[model samples]
Target chain A: MSDNISSSRLTDIDGWGRSESLRSIARRSFQFFYDNYFRVEWEGLEKIPDDGGALLVSNHAGAIPMDAPIIMHGVEQHLGRPVYGLADHFFRQIPVVGTMWSRLGGVPAHPDNAYRLLRDEHQLALVFPEGTKGTSKVFTQRYRLRRFGRGGFVEIAMKAGVPVIPIAVVGSEETMPILFKINSLAKATGLPYFPITANWLMFGPILGTAISLPAKFKLRVLDPVHFNVPPDQDRYSKSRIMDESESIRLTIQENLYDMLAHRGNPWLG
Target chain B: MGRRVLLTGLGTFWGGKVAQSLEKHPDVDVIVGMDVTEPIVELERTEYVRADETYSILSRIVDATQVDTIVHTFLVVDSTQMKTKRLHEINVIGTMNLLAAAGCAGTPVRRVVVKSSGMVYGCTGRDPLWFLEETPRTDPPETTIEDSLVSAEGYLRDFAQDNPHVSVTLLRFSNVLGNDISTPFTETLSRGIAPSIFGFDPQLQFIDEDDVVSAIEFATSANVPGIYNVAGDGLIPWSEVAKICGASNLPLPPFGTEAAASILRKMGLVKFPPEILQLLRFGRGIDNSRFKDLGFSYKYSSLGAVERFAKTKRLSKAIGIPRSPYTYDKDVESFFHHSPSVVRSTQSDSTSDTF
Candidate 1:
């Protein structure tokens, strides 16, 4: 309702890879939790470019991945434009969830899709460099950043010539804190890792960890960092891309620690 | 002396139209229309030759008419309209006949124009976004129809190589859509409920019937050598076309759609051959720059051709009522306004370019 574009102008939000109808339906269903349950607090949205493409690099957590949708909702609500989330290739390999994820503008994390979203379509893209490693981190390692994958995100941003906005999302780690991870059985179920959570084993799976804990969410959007790399440069050059990736990672890690220090308890934001 | 043209497949609707157009041309001194069956419509300045497109008969006709220009329009776009075996004979064996006759000593056929379809570049997941004229024909004959066309083109290439006097021009067209043309594509669009592959919407290219006629006429009038991909400007996703046609999209899983299509075929609900299912799932696209380089311009863009088809369907009271006089969804319009495939091909010269 706060959007400058009229309802008539918003007819069928379907783009190349984004289906507006399904995205809105999923957003509405998730908004109930984003607003009432987690009570998400969004900040620094004006940093996102009003037009043209940009990348939002966020930290991934929560075994169930409520953070991605929450971030997407926050960006959509504040920016009044859609955000395409890049997911792991494994996410699209899953059955019903894969279709739902794609319909909600979750593109496979292939370099081609990333390049097209950012450079070609000129749409906001949300990426988690930490990937599955960040999601499967145990409770003891909460808020600890993992090695961002080979700096592929940096290379994509470099090739696209778009600014990267660092986002640190709090409370995603406590939603369904994993105590143990079982990798042997994960292969059978097509899951990356089978996390044994206190809420799932002790409390019923349906009423427990499956339902994310009501920990308040703080989504902090940092300043945008612009990069200028020649489009034809070899993307595999580690010295340039890795350094950029490490810097972005350090920024998110510092922001995470800052937000954690200010908060009184892990249970309350 | 003015040009004397011999047009094959005059019995077919397209051939008849080409003959009628050439009949009115003052430069064409003689127009000989050849086909085994009688044409449905008769033209004033054209002479009909009742002979099959075999080597012996075609060579005799060539000797008798002494025609300098040959326009071959016999490629059967839809094989279901005729018997499958006869369709094979007409499309494959008939092409071999034309090639042999054109290469015969003192044939006088200096210019050859053959009408082909874009299906030669098979629609597969591995296909490049836009198939250039030089893209190797990688569609290994999956069906009898594909085999026929592939062999026909091969024979044409051989004939052109063996006989240097004849300049062969092959115009590989995308799916032709017009109210008068009853192709499998048009049949699907005309239905109230069109079945599509679930969760997959591939980009489709089209040429209007009028543009096709003009292209053939232009090719016959001029001597443009070598093969060219003849497609109209712009590309539209299949879903957008379905929306513009006001057909309720019935998305069917690939595995289930085959079984359903077979059953529907029995009930007369579906007319497309089973091989066409692959094209429905992954559509074919072609680059039309080679066609434009030949000094011919297309009046109707792919979007315009579709709108014109929809309008004709509306006026003829054939298809369901559209939501409005067909305008594309704004989002789709903006998405393809600057086509990523076209722009990327021009903007970047790297292998990592994404289309």
Candidate 2:
């Protein structure tokens, strides 16, 4: 097939040729304990294509949104192409962080923007189906995924005919074990919920750290499952594709749960 | 024949439950109900003393009834009415008066159980561990109701120390949930709007009224001296509690000095006072494992106490008392209709100015 877009356009859209300063900062931050402290293990890096349109679906945990940066760093290193992220609207309202996020190709998860990013831009979109509810779930309810909320991610992938890649990140839960949920406080702050982790309040100003213990994070990017729809068939026929998509979701969830159960050392081997 | 136990405040919310539980004790010959109001006719008490918990008036009833065990459960907990003077009068001085009366009573006064709050562990600059019976009051910020509690506890501790003959058992309880009195926290929640929670995460512990009464009786019988942490069996996050109570839809603004000022300004019959708001924003969990180790089991533990409390007629009446027709969007209209614009503006100004 003939190349639809020029390499320059692809590079620009992917945020591959962005500011060297930002890239350097990100690289240094991840490399702070790259060899000494945290030894990250990636299981399925081959599943992600070097350059193309795809969807990366992952299980979310961690109080400070730690999983996102790790996934971004890993993808940039392995695929040699920048991955675009779909973030919540609130993040865009921040001052300096918002501008940096935009520069790094973090698009708001508005449906129109997401569709445009996949179809016209041909950039890989990362979406968490369970949303905030999944990440903020109490320790008692961890790993037990909430309802996928009618599978909108599956529909988005099928409509664009992009392959769906299920990614799982273990050790995020162990980093900050949610002791209990502070309902009154969470409701007061307008957040979905805030986990009452051990020493969260007392150690905040003293340490300037939101989470404790740098648990070894194990990322497993499952093999992509492609949805083949005939050219003449309408988008309405996408419901047939959900059964397969759900199987992938469930399979990844089970594998992640099992891995978390058996995995002894937080410092990944 | 054994003498009747004159349990004052039994007719009131917390005391009434305590009186009812004490009735099950075989050693007790009778339970004499006394409060500001008349006792429930259905309650099978030996006698009902319709007297105020004030020292002079209650002293006569104690003399007449020949009450051996005087369980003083009378204390007003209205945060709105707790001015500095009122806090000293009711919580500190009022408790002092009762203790003094019990000490000098004609009848053999064996024990005095005073219900204190865990709010004394004010929000700032303290270690998070089990608050033992002997934990000294650290210098808390002046803006908390916990300050009042600290003063109250100090007075009680001194009184207990002086009158060693009177077995003073102080139960330092967390939020007490039951049907009788409407708590400011749950009442705000029942407004059906998203209640503003403070900075996202603060540990919460609640004690059921059943447990409260059980704890009082345990204190009365065992004559356990010193402070004891009395709370429900399990802990739940406030967010989950709100959701379970169907009050999670309401938005909670960030609680700071400004929020406290606004709450103080909105100090109506329904609103919480500044002191209470301060307590809500920074309160910690209470450890009641000591009570459990003493072979005590709570009847309605956890948020189940809230559910039980909601089932009462008092709650139904309060909830049915028709709020204004204005939606949360029309907060200005709601405030203007409910309170003076000057006060509302001042509240808004204070909140903005402070934080």
Candidate 3:
């Protein structure tokens, strides 16, 4: 029954499940958040290469983690290249959210996905090394980077033969601060952690859970870290992966502190 | 000597298709096909051997035929068609017996190609965007069909390890959509409204049935050993797939999806088995580059496969398909094989292999 049909594509969706039409619409709508709501400011944007693959490592924060979309929108608008945002698999557990996420270029942070996006396709990819631990932290732990996931991101960049460009983000932690967490509710709902965020308390249940505080966002791109070792090996030295991962984390952490130190107010950059 | 090949499940659609394709190869001197029932399609030179569902007589047939290549296309991937125990017997025990026959001391079989489904990966929200051949499923198999396939693949891995001389190639194919094949996806799309989970538009990958057959043939002929993933290039949203099929979706409530599916099943509108249900929620994509790297080029992409099916479906609906559904005749087949009155021609017949 399989007959040949030439030129059958109907949508602009790519193999990564990213649709340029949807991405453009999302970017246009999100432009407000970048310009007015959070008034995002950028530094060292040129550090991100104009072409070829590079892993954009950043400090993840906020209960909803707005850094991902912001970073994706900024790069695509300025550099004219699509950035594949790699996030936790948990986002996929949701129905509408997961579908919209994928169409807007959200990919599960699987090593295979990273390797394919970076090494094979030679496209830009953005990843959060700290994963859930970074986004789920409480207000007290704001700006303090969490431990990277055993340096898996480092190993992936090394394997893909791509340089790791660390980006430090400020004010995301204050966007929707985690006041406290309810472990029982989290366990019941199968969530990593359920937090009673500041947004919820300040704006009632609907707005609090859905919206982030208008905290001015400032971003800085660090130097791209390139591993001297050869790429595409069956295995690499574990010690080297850990060392590279920790150094990258420290670099982002220190830069975050520097960016925060320069800012006098959270809401007013 | 020309290549002698043995095919499993000649009565099934895949088995019959593979046999017809194999008959076209001039180098293939002998084609022996075994199945529980008579072959579905008529064959010119291929010999059909009737065997039980488990293929109890596989060893004797293997020894007698001394076929060099074995194409195991009998695995029942669809769970809705049979009971769990029967599926286990056909998938697990059947594979065990076939492997035993192929691995026996001084066995003639040196190449084996097992056509497996991507259900072995077990769709989950945690799965990677594209599953490489070696990538493990995020969670273990929850459904009976997945469990059976996993166990059968385990045996193949062990057999390959024990019998290093034999080249074992396992092709895990993603969801299939063809003009004649009626999978869960097709069944739903053909109905009044395809059932989809509310608010979920999972991205899926599909391959044309032609690609599936050619892949099996390529595996039998090529020396490339080990496992490889097979599917058309790219992923398409389930919504886009429905649009291509010109079918509207009946979004089942996200909560209590199972209960809704059961009610629909009782209505006999469509079959939403566990695998299909999970796939509807979180569709799957397998990395086909490994197979493509070996010079395999697919005739259709994911969208192309769905588009082809939609075109054929619309045509059939408009003119009431002219297909007569071929039925095998033993007398005519035997007469063609043994009758001295019959004439053999150099050119292949055009009537056969036309789905």
Query: For model 2, what share of native contacts is present?
Result: 0.00
Give the TM-score, chain B only, in order for the candidates.
Answer: 0.86, 0.74, 0.96
- Model 3, position B166: C-alpha lDDT score: 91
iRMSD values, candidates in order: 7.1, 21.4, 1.4
lDDT (tens digit, per residue) of candidate 1 on A1-269: 13221212112424333578877787788888888899898778788888899999999998786789899998887778989898875654443465556567877676766776788779999999999999999989999999999999989988887889999999999888899898887988868898887678667777665688778899899999887666635454779788989999999999999998888766666
Badly placed stretches (over 4 Å) of model 1 are: A1-32, A41-44, A55-64, A86-103, A106-121, A127-210, A215-267, B1-175, B189-191, B197-207, B214-255, B274-311, B314-355
Sort by TM-score, best first.
Answer: 3, 1, 2
Q: How would you encode candidate 1's per-residue C-alpha lDDT over B63-153 as one tens digit per residue?
A: 8889898999988867667776877888888998887887788778899999988777776554544677777655586767777777788
Candidate order by DockQ, decreasing, is 3, 1, 2
Can you list the residue pairs that collide in candidate 3? none
> How much RMSD separates candidate 2 from the native structure?
23.2
What overall lDDT goes with each candidate model? Answer: 0.77, 0.61, 0.88
Q: Estimate each model's TM-score.
A: 0.66, 0.49, 0.95
How many angstroms is residue A263 displaced in model 1 relative to the true structure, after the best TM-score fit? 6.1
- Number of backbone clashes in candidate 1: 0
